[model samples]
Target: MCLLLIAWKVHPTCPLIVAANRDEFYRRPTKPIHRWDDGSGIVGGRDLTSGGTWLGVTASGRFAAVTNVRDGKAEGTPPQSRGALPTGFLDSTATPQAYAAAADGDDFAGFNLLASDLDELFWVSNRFDGAGVAVEPGIHGLSNAQLDTPWPKVTAGKAALAAAVSEDSGAPDADVESYFELLHSTDPAPRADLPNTGVGVRREKQLSPLFVRTRFYGTRASTVLRVRSDGSFDLTERTFNSRRQTGETRIEETS
Candidate 1:
């Protein structure tokens, strides 16, 4: 996912709320949100390219997501592979911080990694400048820029999404499902002066379903994760297969 916004324990009304857009090839392999073994479940789209997922949460309250580093080519050496960091470790493991900190000796840059388990959330970005300051639990926003950055889209979107969840009165699953649509929407109306509207994407479809007709190499998906203070998590995925509605998964027992 290129964009991710999450509201963590800081909120008084809602414990956790996430909205993200997964950008990947149309053919990437990913299953819709569903209950899985080990009592772990996935609610976000997985990376078909590397099997790493953009954003998702485990039933036990672990969460993670990542966005690309948007910048022009630089003068320095670039990484051997864009998929160097194992972001897949976020949702699948418990000791994510220890796992990531172990990669300090390894070369890293060009990608961002965010992860959260039962108690905390953390972020990592390997770039020429350096990895970013680690992030802690609290509402956070991330985009192509960096973690907890004040970029307009990341900052503004986080606030708006948080407000949406706070004001919601219905079931969190329904309210958060609606919030997914808000994040997944990318209305592609043409711009008069800009020609291409400056919007990198041509159309927005759920589940990496939309085809741009160019080798179909693109990212398209959205995942919403909801976690309550009582130690329960839910993941809902909206993909090409399930256009508007999301496939739901209950991680830990809420009842």
Candidate 2:
């Protein structure tokens, strides 16, 4: 996922609320969220090319998401696909911290990963020595940077997400729609505020919004998930391209 806005322990009934958009090239083969054929008890989109996933959840209350770090230089290809970071987390019996600590940072390209179990959230980055940090509860944002880095989009997304949740008066449907609206914005940040990720000004402008659009690359999927303290949850995935949308899939489940 390129952009993720999470309201962790901010809602009384819902412990986790996620609004996220995944950006990728249109040519990459992908499948929308589904029960994994391997009986992993996991549900999320799969990267057909890499046999991994960017984001997914398990019935046992484990959640994982990943974003590629933006490095200007190309190192050809890494030995491992970063998507496996999340898929492996959901598939294993390990805690989030153990899984993150075990990752061999040298095997993959630069990546920022978030892995959480029922009680705590953990963050690990291969670019930053592969140590894991527990994420505290509250509103948080992540993109192609360190956790809660004040990049323009991250800052705006966190604020928008906080507003969306606080304004939601216990209505699930309207609340989810409001969160989607926040993710659907395509406004570019002012040039002065764009982060210097080594990519040029023009490229930075293209990725400034919560939702991004470009000829060959853009947001392919948007997802909203709400996990209640009791483990019942609502998950929705919307797929689209630059010109128009493909479809939306909704999955609701209880513990």
Candidate 3:
């Protein structure tokens, strides 16, 4: 299970709160946040499969994110590498609203996209039975298996992020860094079974309270993006080690 949550403008302190947990096999090759493309911008984590990204914004006030829909057997179509969607969004100039609008009736193929260009944000999910959806700025969440579930983790994370954003507007950078720390606060004790277990012994481990669970499918990367009224952008990305230790990089760029 994975979850993504977003909170916009209504918060008194911060304008946005995005917390997501990306779930996949533990052996996937991913790099924590780092400077990308000759240092023109910075992004957190890279999905080595398709070279796409999960979250990132350019110094030029452009932003976008995407999550794979767990409901698909997206295997024989076009054969694009995994995570290519987010990678493409990172380098593009499409605004969220425009991108969503453009995707309104197109075939979704096999993913969901969150595209933004300085002023607006957009969401489109091909997994939603082939329809694209427009989601406004507010507290929002999504998981790999579904759009939004009433799962306790989704509720708690969204609420916590919302509350924190409402309480701290002083330095977006500081608030963002603290938020990353909070997201990465998971225990590192090795588990005897895989999270998505098919083994009988794993079933026993899943039943153990100490087995450790992930909120948003073990948040692999965390990001914060801010846009000034003048249309410039500032962004930061924090990547976590397998042990969940964290490091961050910040960038500022004009549109």
Q: What CA root-mean-square deviation does each model show from the true structure?
A: 5.8, 1.4, 5.8
- Which runs of model 3 end up more than 4 angstroms from their true locations? 12-14, 38-44, 72-78, 101-109, 129-131, 145-147, 170-173, 185-218, 226-228, 231-234, 244-246, 252-255
Write down the TM-score of every candidate: 0.68, 0.96, 0.70
Candidate 2 stretches with Cα past 4 Å from truth are 169-175
lDDT of 2 by residue, 64-180 (tens): 999999867677688999988998899999988898888888889999998888678888998875489888999999999888999988999999999998976543454478888
Question: Which model, 1 or 2, shows the larger lDDT?
Answer: 2
When sorted by TM-score, best at the front, the candidate numbers are: 2, 3, 1
Q: Could you tally the backbone clashes for each prediction?
A: 11, 0, 7
Best to worst by lDDT, what's the order?
A: 2, 1, 3
What's the lDDT for residue 232 in model 2? 68
Error of 1 at 189 (Å): 12
lDDT of 1 at 236: 59
Model 3, span 1-255: residue lDDT tens: 144666655554434446555544556667655667655464546767656667765655565666655432434555464355555666656656555555532333456677665456666776565334556667766544344553344555566676666665634345565455445434332354223323344432422221124332234455655555454545666555445636666665553
| Per-residue C-alpha lDDT of model 1 across residues 152-239, encoded as one tens digit per residue | 4455567667666676653545556556656754432223211221233433222112111224643355666667776565555555
Predictions in order: lDDT: 0.54, 0.87, 0.54
